[model samples]
Target: MLVKSIEKRVQELNGNLELSLDDIFYTVCQEYNLNAVVIEEALGCKCPFALIGFITTLKSADPGNYIQYKY
Candidate 1:
């Protein structure tokens, strides 16, 4: 799953990725090649804020250290 893959990548990166919200949104959208609406529905969130919250909840990293999709 994407979430699991992201977790694994983050772990491999060793620590936080430190990216802007726009970078995150764009990366996810491009990676999945999904529209914003579809992304929101898939994540069970109505908006970007909620989506971020949902993603954060699924990962083991702290808020400050999450969203780090690196090797």
Candidate 2:
């Protein structure tokens, strides 16, 4: 269900500005009225890496927010 929640949130926040994985996760939590600790526990990951991996999948699926990099 967490992945579903993430997908939905990413869709909702696709416009305006591109957000980092951490921002997306927090936004999803806020939007769904979920506790961060609860989510982390459910995912068995207390770090941002897990969420970043999920966000990468989301970008591949629905890449509305353009990704860019600078060297």
Residue-pair clashes per prediction, in order, are 0, 0
Query: lDDT by residue for model 1 over 1-71, one digit each (tens)?
Result: 65565445434333446755445554554554435555555665433344445565645645332333444
Models 1 onward score TM values of 0.34, 0.42
Steric clash count of candidate 2 = 0
- The Cα local distance difference test for each model comes to 0.49, 0.55
Candidate 2 lowest-lDDT run of ten: 62-71
lDDT of 2 by residue, 1-71 (tens): 55666666666665437776567666665654446555566467644446545455654474333222234
Q: What would the TM-score be for candidate 2 when compared with the true structure?
A: 0.42
After superposing candidate 1, which stretches have Cα over 4 Å from the reference? 6-18, 37-71
In model 2, the runs with Cα more than 4 Å from the true position are 1-6, 14-17, 46-71
